[model samples]
Target: MLQIDLWKRVLIWALVLCGLALAMPNLFYSRVETHNDAVKAIAASGGVASPDQTAEAAEWPSFLPSGLVNLGLDLRGGAHLLAEVQVSDVYADRMDGLWPEVRDTLRAERATIGTIRRVDSAPDELRVQVGEPAQIAQAVALVRDLARPIVSLTGVGASDIDVSAEGADVVVRLSEAEKQATDTRTMQQSLEIIRRRVDEVGTREPTIQRQGEDRVLIQVPGIGSADELKELIGTTARLTFQPVVGRTTDGSADPGARNLLLPSLDNPGEYYIIEDRTVVSGEELTDAQPAFDQNGRPAVNFRFNPAGARKFGTYTAENIGSPFAIVLDSEVISAPVIQSHIAGGSGIITGNFDVEESTQLAVLLRAGALPAKMTFLEERTIGPELGADSIAAGKIACIVAFSAVLIFMALSYGFFGMVANLALIINVGLIFGLLSLIGATLTLPGIAGIVLTIGMAVDANVLVYERIREELKTSKGPARAIELGYERALSAILDANVTTFIIATILFIMGSGPVRGFAVTLALGILTSVFTSIYLTRLFIVMWFERRRPKTIEV
Candidate 1:
């Protein structure tokens, strides 16, 4: 009948084979497997993202019989979580967190402050004390709020603002109700501080929200691999650099308070106290990375922006030979005394940290920063037994669906039915081979997509065969009939697949998650079926015709 040249036959067969190879992974491979727990633990323990991704295969063999489609999260009984960021408290806490330094540092300069202390402080004020009766007038004049109503006004025109001295037997007490109110306000500030810290660690699609005044609920799915989530949500401690107080202009220590030396963690090192204040903070970090020093000891290298770098250099310069604390969330991770002024925008954080924590820190730093902290509300791991059940159910569905298609094709078109069966067989083979070659995850809906492909692919052969019968019945010669059959059937064949293709395109564009998997399989099936049915099957027919010459055509 239709004469397919040897090259056309070979080329068509090659394409069919290629498609099979690409689909192999979908048909045979297990989609759901195992997650790395070691990395997850690290993540929880203040580790970072970018864990070493070397995962070992589970010893338990796959329960999935070969050649099945896999379902996605919905049918697979996986957990999902929703969370939101806490912003209100985060901003308020950040401002207040910076307020203390703003207050006392100005006082050491003898700048007059008012409303500086809280009434047992419901909200701590940077109030100014009336200086030794005489300097008070001059101090108030220079530091006066230029705008009216900015500083609280009392005593007609504030001839003098009054306050008890910081160190005298002076005492200001709050009533029971006032203390409760102050504590509530501070808790609000603390809650906001928590949020800013969480936002610093950019866990993917993480949801952080204020549950009560002080707590935030966080949900991170697909992020439960290691303690990374734990670490990410909790590292909200802030870092600050303050000038040393009670130090003389010549750098000699004053009598007390400012020169206090605190012991370093697990070391003989000590850090000299600066003014009991913090000026610059670690809120503007841009990037960080893990590297090794000359001795090959693991370390974390960091860089800050122009603003951060300039401030950092200034802090280090002033604190040379003095220890500065690297505080995480609240606990000090490292408090190394500064050896020298660290300028030029970058520096290293070093300690007894192993390679893992150092790298995790770098990754956390590079994920920019989290805006707020979170508390893990819930977590669960899918059992391998459940994965096995899914695999088994998926197989049964595929087998039942597949056999039904096979039986229908055989009965519907008789001799041509057999040819359709051959094409169908090749179609599925190509699907598996192609999936394996490409290594696409085979979800369960993806299986349904493959099964649906059967109806579409089988329909194409039916169209061609039915058209061939029409042409043969028209009394044309066998060669002309066969050629015209393929030619005339091409328009209808293409039209049917083109319509299905449009549907597949819509599915691909609109679907999310597993629905997308369906669309992908459907789209791929449409293309493969068109090529194999029209091209490969025709080639087979051509080769058969060449070998089996007959005198007359059978009606």
Candidate 2:
């Protein structure tokens, strides 16, 4: 009997209806996208919306499914940047942090190693000269105690820094294995910080990923330009509070070896000499928000954690009437005198900032600083006009291919061909439905995959139809012929589609960006095609045969 069980029939139709419902929003893509954006904006504004936003949000019914396929960078047009992280900067920072520990450790062994002074070398190397040349070996041994085990898979049992004595100086630098591990960690941290900064702007589906040892690839769709993306992420935003030594009007003035000379934010040509040691850094910040100061000026309010609060309070208590500088990215944003002990662990940063600047600063501070500076190696801004053209072309290609396939199938296989046509249409719908469900971005290559799928979708139906034609010649009844046709062709269909699915899976695993996009659509198309070809079309034919009670039917 050419029959499907009652429950299976319900399941098939249910899935078809659900898929179509999920895909319906893509037909009104722009309107639904606008509605979604408006809804998000309203929620972000604490359930308040402007008249325009409210109207836009109301354009689409809330009861219906609203998820749409996200367009990729190539499809939506946006900023593209390939940046190389200045990973060596982190080495310098690490050495700077290690200096105090080395100084204190050597001072503890001062009786044997004598006094020590830091000598200039490469930015990455920490060279210290011992007053007693004969005890240089002792100084090296003491500094070596400061080395910690590298917590990395390839660096097991290896210390982070290699300490050796050269002449009268104790030379210390990161080990080669430790450098590799640090590079990996720096790239990971840079990628994460960039992602956080981009996500804070509320963009849809930005791709920020590590490309190589010291590089990151960032593609942000719907952004204005590449420069805008750069400006958003490039600032580092390393905030610190340090005690001020003095103020100067000269840029070339030296502030000693352990201090820094930074320019003021508001006053032109005015600089301040600040201590290099920070009282509390941005890493201790628990929260930051854009708010107005007491004078109604734009400012950023920040709160610190308990440990940071204790340190800050103690410093303020001891430094009454002394000025402290708020430094951001090595520039003095503010230098204010401490009037009394500030025990609240909260403070405000007031600079020459507008509302937008303050908001951006708050966002950057909240996102945390990038581990290292990144230099853009490649940058390109895609225009919306190009994206629109590509989308239009893709739509035309899909429609033409679809119409040609439908016409050819209808003429060759007759009624059965039309059934295959219906299945193919539903197959495409299910693909989009799955894509939307997964929040997958659709690129130009993904569209090409869909067009290819339109042709491949009917392969199983064709095999089954040809098999039925052969069975009919062997004098079998229409029902038996149809049953045997699907049963016999099942192995071949599975073999072909399964092989293709494996290839798609491999491509998805090994590829990135647009290649993965193509693989995703291809894989989904295969699954949906198999379901429709083997089950849904067969169900329709079985229902038709049962209704007519046909003894024989033409292929």
Candidate 3:
């Protein structure tokens, strides 16, 4: 009964060997990490590695597994930021876009709704006053027809916009369901753009995720500070081309109803009145790079997609000799006259830009624009010195806990206890091996979970050994007593570990950040401990029994 099947024996040994092999890289973490990064960089560069990079990549053997457990912020230091997206900004932009369509629809029925005039209203509302009060109902109905069914899962059968009439004025706003859908899209886009921006900088293991309907939580390990992280992602980088109506020195100049007056970036106090409708938005841009102008001044070169190129070429041809303003986040970066038909859909933006500004602009343009503005609600920078201290403290705690558990087990059960201690050592190794194989993050709380696991690794052996002692008082032989002990202990061992694993799973699902990290290590440790204690320790004892067939044994 104590004999393991041949297949089972092979499986157990193979699992252990594979786990150790996968986790071996962590023993030389720095070297392995460098090799991995170098390999990635060379691959990205079309497999052409520099001499230094090739030498660094050769430090680790090609056949060995290179995966290492990622270190968490508390163990590696980084920047953390909680930002709330202004979803209302998108609502206002949607309302602005709806105005042209509303005007066209109303103009076709001018005899019925009278002369409709756009009126100033709330940012989220599109308001229009009708000259004929009697036709207000018809006007509302016509605007309501503009509403399309929302295609989102949660917004099924709901209209995208709600149309209501306030006296002679028809007001339009996004429906509640549409607003919810918009918020979800905004958060998703923000998360993706943030990830792209952070990844472009090559920061290792940056966490960019949405916290709620309108908030994002970003953590970047090995980054300098929260401010630096914010600077990298904060700029909206909204570039637009609008026809310049007029130029003035007065900031208070009213540039008519459909024009906006923005101050020039290069010239202080100088302002330009530009058309509100963008000729081509940066969303159509496909590429942006920093390059020197013909005069050797820093500038940004941009290329547009096909549709954008066609529109830009047509606009440039029609508006030749007129100045067009390049606006970035409400500031007029430059105003240049259309000299030619610019058919290729490529152009240069020249400003009083330094080399760094041009480079940053290019990076922002390449990463695309954020869907909405974000207000940082919380920010913190964790120092590497604190992380180092945490690592040292965690190591000391693990060593002390491990030593105490080892001594206690050896004293309690003698030679059998020593076999369990050996299994315990391998148990810890298996924990690290699984963690490395899975690429789980190691945090301070995770370290505590592993230490706790070390203390509990011999639990199954304790149960079986105590049962053996109980059986020895009976008339059973040593081999029969041992087999019966293991058989009787199996059910209790399964029940305890299963229940504990369920709790760990719940923690991982419900908790955030460090708690999840702790749950991961705890769950993995429980699995590894059960395997080593029941199977590996039993195999050791069986081998000892075969080697020395004694009639009686000491408990």
TM-score of each: 0.61, 0.92, 0.83
- Per-residue CA lDDT of model 2 for 1-555, tens digit only, reads 788999999999999999989999999999999999999978865697999999999989999999999998888899999999999999999998899899999988888888889989999999999989998878888899899999999999999999999999999999999999999999999998999899998888898888868889999999999999999989899999999999999899988989899999979899999987989999999889888899999999999999999999999999999999999998898898999999999998998999789989999999999998889999999998889898999899999999999999999999999999989989999999988888899999999999888888888899999999999999999999999999999999999999999999999999988999999999999999999999999999999999999978898
Best by lDDT: 2
Return the number of clashes found in candidate 1: 72
* Model 1: residues with Cα > 4 Å off, grouped in runs: 4-14, 21-79, 90-286, 292-297, 305-307, 375-379, 429-441, 550-555
The residue ranges of model 3 lying beyond 4 angstroms of the native Cα positions read 5-7, 152-154, 209-213, 239-367
Candidate 3 residue 208 C-alpha distance from true site, Å: 3.9
The C-alpha stretches of model 2 lying farther than 4 A from their native spots are: 244-261, 266-274, 291-301, 316-324, 334-352
Clashing pairs in 2: none
RMSD of each: 11.5, 2.6, 4.4
lDDT of 3 by residue, 180-263 (tens): 999888888898888888987778777777786788999888899999999999989898999999999999988999999999
Q: Which residue window of length 10 is worst by lDDT in model 3?
A: 1-10
Model 1 lowest lDDT segment of ten: 146-155
State in Å the error of residue 476, model 1. Answer: 2.8
